[model samples]
Target: MARYAEVVRWPLVEALAAYEHRLREHARRQYELDFIAWCILAQSGATKRKRPPALPTILKEE
Candidate 1:
């Protein structure tokens, strides 16, 4: 369990740092929001499917 704790702790710290940076940059709040969602998903052991697209994907269907 020690290994797991170390791994989890570092990422949590990093996420907080990133969140602070985003707040300074005055970017949209969505990124910080998404980070919180991602943490919840990780804790729930919900397997994520394929990675998200590198760029935003917009659908223009009629």
Candidate 2:
């Protein structure tokens, strides 16, 4: 079975880079995408986090 962290990490790395690139091209409002992408990265990494922003609610809820 695939390790869960390894599986999750690949997409996170890709998304963060993509979001950062897109953020530079987008208008100011689009900063939200970059912010949310980072929240996911910081949250999922389970690193030493000091008061990370709350993720925007419910882009896709199960």
Candidate 3:
């Protein structure tokens, strides 16, 4: 997992940083919510009791 993290997580972090940098540059309206707030809202909508479908289950059904 550590090896995977170094290869995968580092690129994801860099991509997200680039995305946020572009958003700051091009967005006309400033975001009312910060990153932490957006993360909380994202996870709040995906609670354990109301989770999204599992990838395996969906693939099997298809």
Reference-based TM-score of each model: 0.34, 0.29, 0.28
Best by TM-score: 1
Model 3, span 2-56: residue lDDT tens: 8666657667778787766666544323332343455576687845334333333
lDDT for each residue of candidate 2 in 1-61, tens digit (9 for 90 to 100):
4766665667777867776655555533354666666688787885655455453333222
When summed lDDT is taken over every stretch of 10 residues in candidate 3, the lowest stretch is: 51-60
Q: What is the lDDT of residue 5 in candidate 2?
A: 67
> Over the full model, what C-alpha lDDT does candidate 3 score relative to the true structure?
0.50
Candidate 1 residue lDDT tens string, 32-57: 56666766777777679223223212
**CA RMSD of each candidate after superposition:** 16.1, 15.7, 15.5
- Arranged by lDDT, best first: 2, 1, 3
Cα misplacement distance, residue 7 of candidate 3 (Å): 13
Candidate 1 Cα RMSD (Å)? 16.1
C-alpha lDDT of all candidate models, in order: 0.54, 0.58, 0.50
